[model samples]
Target: MLVMLTGAFGNLGMATAEALVRAGHDVRALDLDTKISRARAAELQRTAARAGINLDVRFGDIRDATYVRHAVLACDAVIHHAAILPPTTEHSPELARAINVGGTECVLRALEELRTPGRLIFPSSVSVHGPRLHERPPVTAATPTRGTDEYTRGKIACEEMIRASRVPWVITRVGVSPDPGASSVTLDTLRMLFRISPKNRIEYVHRDDVARAMAAAVTCDQALGKTLMLGGGKGCRITHYDLIQTLFDALGLGRVPFDAFGDESYYTDWMDTDEAQRLLNFQSGRFEDYQAELAARMRPIRLGLRPGRRALRWGFLSLVRPR
Candidate 1:
C-alpha cells in the first residue's frame, strides 16, 4: 500500500510514518516547507532507507489543492494528521481554520477529483467530546461532540467534512499524547493543563500506539467508515493531579499540592478502546511504560537540576494557583 501522510514531520506524523514503513507500506509524505519539517524529514528518510522502505517525501502546503493533489497521487490510503494544534489554534483562529479545516477540504477535494476509493484515516482528538467529567465513564464513538473551544470546533468541522465526502473514511478519536522525550514545554501549554480540574479523568496514550493505530487502519477492512476510540486502556486512566505529579516526581521537581489545582472538568477522559482494539490491535502500551520513558528521558537533566530543587519547587508552587 502507498499511504499519503499529511503533516509527516510532526510528533505524531513522524511516528506514523515510521509505523507505515515498518508495516511494509510505501509512504507519500507531505508537510509545509518549514525549518522544523526540514530537520525531521531527513531523520525520517534515513530511518526509512535503513528499513528498505520507499518514502516519497514532499514539502508543500496542504491548503493548496494542487500541492495536495500531487501528494495524493496514486496513494492507496491517506492519514491526514496535519493541523495547527492548540495554543496556536486557540490564539489564531484564522490560521488554525485555514490549516486545520481548510487543509482538510483540499485533501478531500483532491481525493474527490481523482475519484480514488482509497481509505481516509483521520486522527481526531478526544477533546471533540468536550469536558467529559461526570457524564460518561469511558467515552465512545457515540458520544456527542462539543466544540467548546476553537481547537475542538475546528476538529469537529473537519470530521463533519470527512463524513460528508464519498471517500472510505475512519476517524480515530485519540486520547491525550504527551511526548515523553520533549525537552521543553511552553507557558501556554502549562496554563492549559493547569486549567483542567484535578478531578478530571485523563487517558494517556503513547505516541507510538497512536501511530500504530493510524497505520493499521489503512488496511483494516472492518474499520472503514467507522469512528474508533483509542487509548492505553484501563491502566492509562488517571486523574489530572496524578498525571502532573508523576511528571514532577520523575523530573526532580516537587509536586504541587492538590488544593492548588482547578475544580472544573477538562476535555480528557478515559476511552473505551474495545471496539478499536478488536479491529486495529494498537493498544500495547501502559501508563507505567509512559512513566518509565519520561523518567529515562529526563534523567540527565534531572540530575543537573537536582541542586536547584528547592528553587524549582518554590517556583512551581508559586505558579500553581487554581484557575
Candidate 2:
C-alpha cells in the first residue's frame, strides 16, 4: 500500500511513518518543513534508509489546496495527522483555523477529486471534549463535544470537515499520556502539578499503539465512518500525584516544589474501548509502565544537565537518529 503521511516530520508523524515502512508499505511524507533544519532532514533520511525504506519528503503547506491535492494524488492511502496543537493555538486562533480547519477541507477535496479508495485516518485528540473534566462520567464517541479552548475547537472542526467528505474515513479520539517515545503534555502537567507526588487520574496510550490502530483501520472495512476512542491498557490507570512521585523517586532527583492550578481540560474522560477493541483489535500500555521506561532512558543523561539551544539542535538530530 502506498501511504501519504501528512506531518510525517512531527513526533507522531515520524512514529506513524516508521511503523508503515516497517510493515512494508511504500511511504511518502508531507510536512511544511521547507526550511527544516539540516540535522532533522538528515536524521529522517538516515532513519528511513536504515529500515531499508526511503520516504519521499514533500515540503508544502497543507492549507494550500493545490499542494494538498498534489500530495494526495501521489498516494493510495492517507494518514492525515497534521494539525495545530495547543498553547500556540491558544495564542493564535487564525493560524490554527487556517491549518487545522482549512487543511482538512483541502485534504477532503483532494480525496474526492482523486477518486481513490484512500483511507483517511485522522488522529484526533481528547481535547475535543474541551478542557473541562466530565462531571458525569467517562466519555465515549457519542459524548457531546464542548471544546472550551481554541485548539480543541480547531480539532473538532477539522473532524467535522472530514465527516462531510464522501470518502473512507476513520477518526480516532486519542487520550492523554503519550508513550515514552512521544512528547507528552501529560508528563509536563504532572511535573508542574506534583513535583514530589502529584495525584490525579488520566488516560494514555503508546505511540506505537496509535500508529497500528490507524494502519489497521486502513484495511478494516467495518471501521469506515467510525470514530474509535483509544486509550492505554486496562490496568493503565494511575493517580497523578503517585505518578509524579514515582518519576521523582526513580530519577533520584530532589523534590521540586509545584503548585496545582487544576486544568480539568487537560484530563480526557475515560475512553470506551469496546468499539476500538472490536474494530481495530487495538491494545495500549499503561502510563506507569511507559513512565518506567522513560525514567530508565533518562538515567544516562547527567542530572542537572539543563538543555539549551543544543537540545533543540540535538532534538532535531534525534528525530532521524539511526533506528
Output the number of the TM-score-best candidate: 1
Per candidate, the number of residue pairs that clash is 0, 7
Alpha-carbon lDDT of model 2:
0.70
lDDT of 1 at 256: 70
lDDT per residue, candidate 1, 1-323, as tens digits?
A: 99999999999999999999999899899998899998898888898899888888899888898888878888899999999887788889999999999999999988888765688999898999988787767888988999988899999998999999998899999998888877778866776677778889999899999999999999999998899998988889988988998888787887677776766788889889999999999988888888899899889988998999889877776675654
Model 1 regions more than 4 Å off: none
- Please give each candidate's TM-score: 0.96, 0.80
Per-residue lDDT of candidate 2, residues 53-91 (tens digit) = 767777888988888887887576899988877666777
RMSD (CA, Å), candidate 1 to true, equals 1.4
Runs with alpha carbons beyond 4 Å of true place in candidate 2: 34-41, 44-54, 131-136, 179-200, 250-266, 300-302, 305-323
lDDT of candidates 1 onward, in order = 0.88, 0.70
- Show pairs that collide, candidate 2: 43-320, 131-265, 197-241, 198-240, 198-241, 199-241, 200-240
